[model samples]
Target: MGDLTLHGSVSPDSLKEVDQFDGQEMSAAEKARLEQIVWRKLDRWVLPIATIFYLLSFLDRSNIANARVAGMQTSLKMSNYQYSIALTMTYVPYIAAEFPSNLLLKYVGPRWMLPTMVTIWGLVATMQGVVKTYSGLLACRFFLGLMEGGLFPGLVLYLSFFYPRERLQIRVATFFASASLSGAFSGLLAAAITNIDGKGGRPGWAWIFILEGIFTFLFGFTCFFILPNSPATATFFSTKERHYVLARLKEDGAVSSDDKSDNFSWIEVLRCFKSLHVLMLTPVLFVLGVTLYGLAYFEPTIVAGLGYTGNKAQLMSAPPFVVAFVVSMITAVIADRYNCRGFMIIFFTFCNVVGFAMFYAAKSNHVRYGSLFLTITGCYCSAPPAITWVTNNSAPHVRRATSVAIAFIMTNAGGILATWLMGSLSPAPNYTKATLTNLIMSIASCVLACVNLAYLWRQNRLKAERRQLMTQADEPEGMGDESAWFVYKL
Candidate 1:
């Protein structure tokens, strides 16, 4: 057949039109097989490594919850308010560091920046173990936040360099699913580690931080060797294969060729701040962060209150994350397969609405426990699509980096709120204030999703209608995403 589509989306006409001077043309079947080979290579080398780093990132941050249940609060003599203060400390630097971090990520690139951030945060996480005083613990949390802040938005931008728009959600989801897996793994691992109480002059909660942090710290160095800076420099690919990868991205409108230019400027950062879409996205991202950190930093406590205790509560926490991981992957598969992003996001947010509602009102332990699954599923599934939506749409590498960073600030703000949500203040079981706040945030997120989708849909229509007059006549490398030719994946 003369007709062939890559990932069932890219067609021959657009491919040829965009890259008319491509080295050669092949039959549909030949092209399809080549793409499969390339994607497999990328998935093998890229996905797992990214997933690994993110898993550690999450584990180190959330393990504080595990520590709390294992007597961390008592050891440090922290009040609920004091504990909340420490939890909130991490996010302030985390949000503050994002803008500069985005600029640095662009200047240095992920190959170097990502591993460096991980290593520092990993060290900070390990320090969390050795903290003897409340002030000492607070300092560790603050620096940990500072170091870890950049990696997430950096990872989102990094993936865009390799994957096209149609294929982005699945790839983003695959690694983003690491958050859920990390949740599961953290609970299981914490149970085992915390059992070794009073080992080597350290409490059980201390080990939870020490061991996990050390592993994460060491793993960061390996990423420096493994991660390719960009498709252009990926050592695993032949020159020909590299060309094909770059061409595919350009043809798919995943990026403008000029996007690779090293023209990072303050103007680009300003544009991100000025972007209405990006601004609107901040509130949604804020809520997204709320749901995720709400569950993550507090789930162990939530489980402890649900008639489960000690290792049993930790064990119980794992299952919901496991389920969430599965739901996240499945949702991603469906979203990517249908080439639908916004609607899928809307659906996922609404799922969270139901989850938070049930979690707030349910009285039975079984019912309450079951609601955990819904909450995790909704939070984990929604993130990849949301990040993918922003990353896949923004153009000129600088703008994407800046937009994601801008939006991510709200996520850290949400983390700040989540730190105080339940904790010692609201207690456990019912957790009235926390539940009510989460419920309200979920409903707000749903509304924001609708608003974002409508805006995207309208933009898509306008772009489509004026398609005839669109041209890249102004800038040499292309006008970035501002070019009318750019297509939103909504």
Candidate 2:
């Protein structure tokens, strides 16, 4: 028999697909016990795979900064303005690629799609080393951005498919912490690789690209074996375990079980943009690009400007990221446990405000350097929760995918702005403009956090009141967050 479709839904018989077994006889406590066992198994496989892949993505993308300090500019004969343009070029294609890339990820299985992107971009990152002319470098970066664009949004969506909403932020943070891990690792690697200066007619900066890209490419092959498309397809699970996992997600209001969310829909993609949460969250993320990209692309440069020139500067940039990785994990636990993502974002961003204000006002090098810790803390910690916030509220696959994609699309645009803020023309020692910009972005993020929280709270109230009146057939559109059953996370 054909599956029964629901009104205003792409999915049919939401629970029927997962009700294959006699598990209905089990008590809630037994289900809970099994859920814990299944989740722990998933965590062992999922978190490490996602975190390591993200670390490579971040490393390959941001290692250019470390290479720059290692003499990429003088070796390649590019001017500072030209350097900044090269950075900006990466993001232009990056931003253009995400929306479509996300749609494709929906159409295709992430197991097949995610590793392919990493492998191709890893190759692109390798080719970045061999470019003789500035144009060649620009072309590599552009394609690199094109290949790498889908990864983050893809990974987030991939995790959402396996885990329920509440368990997500910390898992997201686990992978996202790899950004800071990359920062630290990239610095240490760049510092060591610089010792290979003039090897095989290549400068140390070029070697940084070669080695890291090769490693990233190799890692991509492993992802193919590691990731399963979804719980239904995960070979590691027993038949009973698989059905139980799906049932747990279904109970969490993940969506209609037979909804087949992986099947692409243009309507769902377009509909997500109209969401009030997506609408408001887009600009807030855009504003946050100041610190996010600023720290990623220029931490080495920023540290260098503070007086630890060359390799010493790269090494110095490593600590804050190390600190950020630890702090980000702790922050995720608190936010998850308390269910206060909105408050966590505001608190962490406010730290950036203080960090930037301190950086801008500091008289000594040490103090300015110390402030980098605070800036890294806020920039890295707040983002996982922020992105997950949108995904948590969104339903089915397409809406969650689009909502997540749009958040990053705008954030990548902010990446371009972040690139411009610290470009060659900025003041040398103080970088007063970048400082002021980050400070303003931090403060604005805090304000928007409050506003977004308040708005969601209001919507939750309205939904609660209207929920009783809602009929299954007359419920809100499947793609819409306006459904009485859908509560926006504050």
Candidate 3:
């Protein structure tokens, strides 16, 4: 009776006797109950507020593509290449700003920092609507990137505070999928807003910026009241439930305290350079980012290639994004459920490769449009898992932050490069070169996935052999040297 009683009780005395602390024997029922508590934590606050925050941020940042076709380019008298430069400008500060911002997020608390950044970016996005000259537009784009830079990588780190490693990929995927919706929704929203061109002597593109920015500002205010700072500071749960979560998280080797340390330095920055994992991950992310950003940078041009009118082209862009949004979510769920990030990534990249190849080969508009759906779907599908794979392998909180920052910076750099490469020269009917480049990038990404897998397998084998040797010897307690012994997953 005493042993049976331990199974259901949460008393300190009972908890101490329940089982080993490895998290290996948590029965399905216990896990289900814990998950219910976690869900309650999520549905009550996390998902709703995060969705609104990220959705608005993403929409405001990316909606410029939609706004350009609506009227911004014409109103500002910018050429196709110049508009591409404007799009590329936003990523410049974004690439430079994420690491420092994440450090601030850790110190100042996300509740204040995230909301403040959102409001600032919201104001900047609104200001973008008012820009009359090329220089004004450039200034606004740079500032917009500066403000929105840390939100995503910071969000990933923030989410780790709430979820275990196994579950984080799905949640991150879900958060990122919000960006996909921005793509899908921005088209529809721009379609409606573009009709307001003559209403107040303002262009339809200005209205796109104004309306989306207002929505973003409002969401930011809401986030101030709703976003939880961390598990340590969370107030929604009862004290015992918080303790339960913190203790369980510790059992899983996910406690963030292990990574916290003194101020950053060039030495810490150089640490990432020494890791083979970062070496392997950077190129994969670079190519993936190039392909994804190429698609984003050129979506409007691609849609217009179908020989549609302006508004219809804006509206037609919606379907491919909608397809990508759905496919990405499904891929994330499957990858997280089975812990199969590497293989799933390879599969999705293969799909992207084939999709891009089809776009390059197809001659007819209908065939090209069909390929757009496939290309967007498959390329977007691979991103979540590929990113999650990187995150899952990185360790220690500070090191993980450095690793993700490196990947994100490279990705943003890719965005900058793709913006130029897919410029006016490749517009419609002759975008075959751009499409072929995307196909090659996708194929290269698949090869990296295989290389990563093989490396991880070799590392795992080494780890197992070391563990066996240690067990066979008589070593003192607490003799595990993390530097020599701990090997990260691929």
Instruction: Point to the candidate with the largest lDDT.
Output: 2
Which pairs of residues have clashing backbones in candidate 2?
A: 11-259, 14-257
TM match of model 2 to true structure: 0.93
Whole-model lDDT values for every prediction = 0.79, 0.81, 0.72
Best candidate according to TM-score: 2
User: Candidate 3 local accuracy as lDDT?
Assistant: 0.72
Q: In model 2, which regions exceed 4 Å deviation?
A: 1-24, 260-266, 470-480
Question: For candidate 3, what is the TM-score?
Answer: 0.89
Cα lDDT of model 1 overall? 0.79
* lDDT tens digits by residue: candidate 2, 145-205: 9988888888887787777778889999999999998999999999999999999998899
Q: Which of 1 and 3 is ahead in lDDT?
A: 1
Report residue 466 deviation for candidate 2 (angstroms): 1.6
List where candidate 3 sits over 4 angstroms from the true fold: 1-31, 256-268, 471-490
Residue lDDT tens for model 3, 235-325 = 8876545656666555444452322232444554566677666677687788777777777757876788778768898888888889888
Q: RMSD of each candidate?
A: 4.4, 3.0, 5.8
The TM-score ranking, best first, is 2, 1, 3
